[model samples]
Target chain A: MQDYSAHIQCSACPIRHRAVCARCDTDELSQLEQIKYYRSFQAGQTVIWAADRMEFVGSVVTGIASLTQTMEDGRRQMVGLLLPSDFVGRPGRAVAAFDVTATTDLVMCCFRKKPFEDMMLHTPHIAQRLLEMTLDELDAAREWMLLLGRKTAREKIASLLAIIARREAALQLKKAKGMLTVNLPLTREEMADYLGLTLETVSRQISALRKDGVIALEGNRHVNIPDIDRLLEEAGDDSDGGMLV
Target chain B: MQDYSAHIQCSACPIRHRAVCARCDTDELSQLEQIKYYRSFQAGQTVIWAADRMEFVGSVVTGIASLTQTMEDGRRQMVGLLLPSDFVGRPGRAVAAFDVTATTDLVMCCFRKKPFEDMMLHTPHIAQRLLEMTLDELDAAREWMLLLGRKTAREKIASLLAIIARREAALQLKKAKGMLTVNLPLTREEMADYLGLTLETVSRQISALRKDGVIALEGNRHVNIPDIDRLLEEAGDDSDGGMLV
Candidate 1:
């Protein structure tokens, strides 16, 4: 058996506290380390395509990946956006259901499918952790559904920005208050795809938000939110601040 | 203590084969039955509101319930449509996350929260089955995201009809291949909230589909499809047909 433990240390990984292995104890971690390997993908690379046979199930270790679906006419909608620590692939199903692509340079900690399923039977921690993660993803997906189905183009832009900023703030705790800067992983066209708007609408809405003093753009990819609460308001979120995140 | 087992037999339950209790054996089912009781809600009744304390987690036993979120200004989006056998309530959370409303008269099999959580800790089958159900719901939610974010109003209508038809077919089993009729649980206004269209737009699209011979309407509720395959095409689904289900 290959000693896969040398790939990465779970102790020092950035996403250690949040990933599927979050609830793992030392022995369970060692078991996972033995079966795990790391895979990397460049920006704009396909991680896995829908209906393809997947040999492994994994978690996003670094950067961003997107779960997207394309219609027969070539129209695409991004269903889920994966930041570090978000899971990928489903257990029990050999074929992937949606196209997963690396929207940013990506790295994944993977375990071969069969053994992982077997281990899950014996390891309740992993299965429980996966359930929690899946539940959270389901909630996020529902929130995104609300954004897609009802929010206006301008609200969509603000909501996306606020979501990205809030996620960033989650990682760098000190930068959450007052003014904050966030780098958007998607381009304008991609944002349009995610929000169900045309590229022109996305661009126009971003400009409109900037002009309205709800946000500021530092560079092409960097957005400056002088007040996070103000941005949330523009997103049509409630004063409770629980709407988008 | 209250002789709850006398309330219902797991074997006779309609959703037994599909719900969170699906994998439970006779012994496990006995434990569930001890803690289970039935709750009924009338059409248009609010089952639970967002953030309200929920005493139990349960499964929809009959009719339809909708998971919806509303903004301060009164914009509402229906995030999930629950059918019989669909699970309800998050396991770890004490409060509900969305307003669950019975779109039709509904019945649910409920287990009080504390005992249910304790039961899950000991019963791998229940937890495993719940995990599987959650994962399936997540997949459905993502598919819904795609519909909300990308599909046109006409395509959206077709997709909703196709989804309801396919789900109904899953229960009936014999009607999968060809022509079929489906009972739409949501009214035009409810459907509008669901599909992100105004009521007028929904009525117009339904009229357009009927005029084009894509679907036939009987009164206000039942929809007749002469060709399910043709309807799927109008929904922009691929030939292999895994898009909406």
Candidate 2:
């Protein structure tokens, strides 16, 4: 059973406060409804082709999507990960610049391009909020550039684990003593793509980390951090702990 | 004698339009004058410290600069190359996140931060223009992210050359058959920092490109491209050539 509610309410919703859509009012949501539609994609499906015509802009209501770029030789790079409540698509552009693929079952709350741009023009706050988010994304991208260009292979692997662990910790979960656990949302191959390394390298690095007692692995995708400080040291970051702050 | 008069104009001005200060109106310029100052740095001078207090926001009125991040062990990544017209600071940020350094004899047009933000509230147009330029910078950052996260070493070098050559071509200078050249602008060490390679790797890759006849080197700091298409192919990029188009 699927839930497809048209109204955009901020309170009591699972994604309330965190999602950018939370900023909109009932009136703005109503205006959005006049020009909006709903769409869903199955896991492993591509929602849009690279450089193909894009007639809509939208946000994710549920599930995860990834924005990826592919080379002619079949090499792929995952440039962005779109989680639930993440925004997708672009306004003022007629073509999608990258491929939007569903990494899991996904639902999108979409708006037709023309009317959405009109709404952006009429609603100054919307554009302002978008600007702020875009700036934040830019900062994140630059930070990633540093990681990709300068970090060692071990450092890269550690950084990736730290990022996942921090993100998972922020999901309003309770912390337990002597046990820190995080689920690996991505496969080794996907992690390799994101880290600019090969799958074999990713596998080897994970094993190395485990052998060095920096981490404990349970199953293929579950990570247990015995000591967060040890994990941070393995990451080669400042002793500021694994949190981004 | 300095030609300050020749450089003074608004963003709408036809001849002197490269500096970010060009976005100011006459009144805004006067306001800027009250809080502004000029400083010059010799080539290789560090202008700002990463993670330190940033007292001002400014632009390069002449010459070139770079924004770079360094690892704790001294590995470096050039996050941005600041050409004329490039804004040098973030508005809401109180401390520098990366180090800024001059790559040539640099003259800057700067404004004190408190006064600038105060003015931004009153002059929506300036804020709007700033927003547009910021958005453009963000796009450039995203493009760089793809370069760092995905490109091979050879592709990275070729892409950097192509970017420099394309921007140089846009100045509409007279073309010389043997002079489709770009001044290296960066030293071998700086190139290493920017490309995430060692100095030896940078030299080796440049030699390989020359040996392959993809590009011609004139001394160590100048490059000549026989054909843009050849360069693009070596970059592993499609010859959409939309940049020049």
Candidate 3:
């Protein structure tokens, strides 16, 4: 764990426009500056365990994290992937409902739960912005459900690739069209957990996609899309309508 | 379709305390009343097709409705089930993302899109309440994702039964404990669509549960859980933890 508690001015933040505090005015940002702190975790660190008490709610400042659930018999499923600017922790809940683990060395901007909840009551911008983000997340989760329940193994791989490619493009401030590349942030086992497939199946599907020319692999972790539309077609998504999200 | 334009007083509404207007004051309610109207749909009627222009947003006043997505080949998946007081339509979005159909004859309290959006902008209470509800819905959706992605067929059936039982209990203001009876709002085929199971598999699992004394069936649409804990155990959930939702 990296404990760098130095205060960073809100205006200097990289995620200023995309984070939960995106809509906050100067006074609100100053208020958040008073309540916010930074925390960093090494890759594979468990940030919060399921059912544990969570004292803070925050957003990812850098790197990746995942929310996962495990059965009594040890079957685990990754329910959410949190990337840069993604919000974490429920506003009104004291206890965390899922285990949140950092998939890469990560930094988060956090606010003490009580103050944050109080701030939410006073700031309509925060509440409304959070609502919009949550709704978007809900839409994304439903799309994931469709992939998990109905899509075949190959389609699942294609869909995951497309999702990552889009996210990567967005992060780079580039259009998600024509030639695109994405570095796989997760391992094959993690991809399997996220996609409801086994490691062997995930590996097989990646190889299949590579062979089919829907995507090219420069290495195990890097993927190149020759044509975004063809990749979307393989993912069984609407290639023209941009409806997959 | 039934069109009922008669205005119902907000004070006399059954869901006054639980709907999106739950946090609204008398003045706000009067504003809502001015803009609200009633629309009813027969069972099996399509309320909104996917990608169609959504002219209004509303809450279910009576009976069950579902949001479903259909693939090009006609495979369908139910993304959401809307019961009484459950919200319909998304604010800030012009097009409906899913095909909403009434599973039972339904009545809704609706507000025109432009007015509702404008009202949400002016009313912090409505926006906050909607944020809370959307968060709850997101939590429920993630739980559903776990079931869809990882649970076994038997566990899936048990989980669905438990979900319905809990919802039914909540609607009736009864405790979801001890011996409980539930009337299945969804047909076997509909349940299959929601659970990602074939109708045959659903039937087989129901029969298996009945034979094993985990549940008792009075008819196709009526189910009795002899012991709620036992059912939860069969569902592979923590009976004491209340994590199934």
What is the TM-score of chain A, computed separately for every candidate? 0.91, 0.86, 0.90
Q: Relative to the true structure, how large is the alpha-carbon lDDT of every model?
A: 0.80, 0.71, 0.81
* DockQ measured for candidate 2: 0.48
- Note the B-chain TM-score for every model: 0.91, 0.86, 0.91
What is the CA-based DockQ of model 3? Answer: 0.68
Stretches of model 3 off by over 4 angstroms after superposition: A1-11, A14-16, A176-178, A239-245, B1-11, B14-16, B173-178, B239-245
For A22-108, candidate 3 gives per-residue lDDT tens digits of 667898888888888889999999999989999998988878899998888877789999876778988988888889999999998
Model 3: lDDT of residue B243: 32
Please provide TM-scores, in order, for all candidate models, with all chains considered together: 0.93, 0.85, 0.92
- Candidate 1 docks at the CAPRI level of medium
In candidate 2, residue A154 scores what lDDT?
A: 84
Residue pairs with colliding backbones in model 2 are B11-B22
> What's the residue-level lDDT of A35 in candidate 2?
80
Winner by DockQ: 1
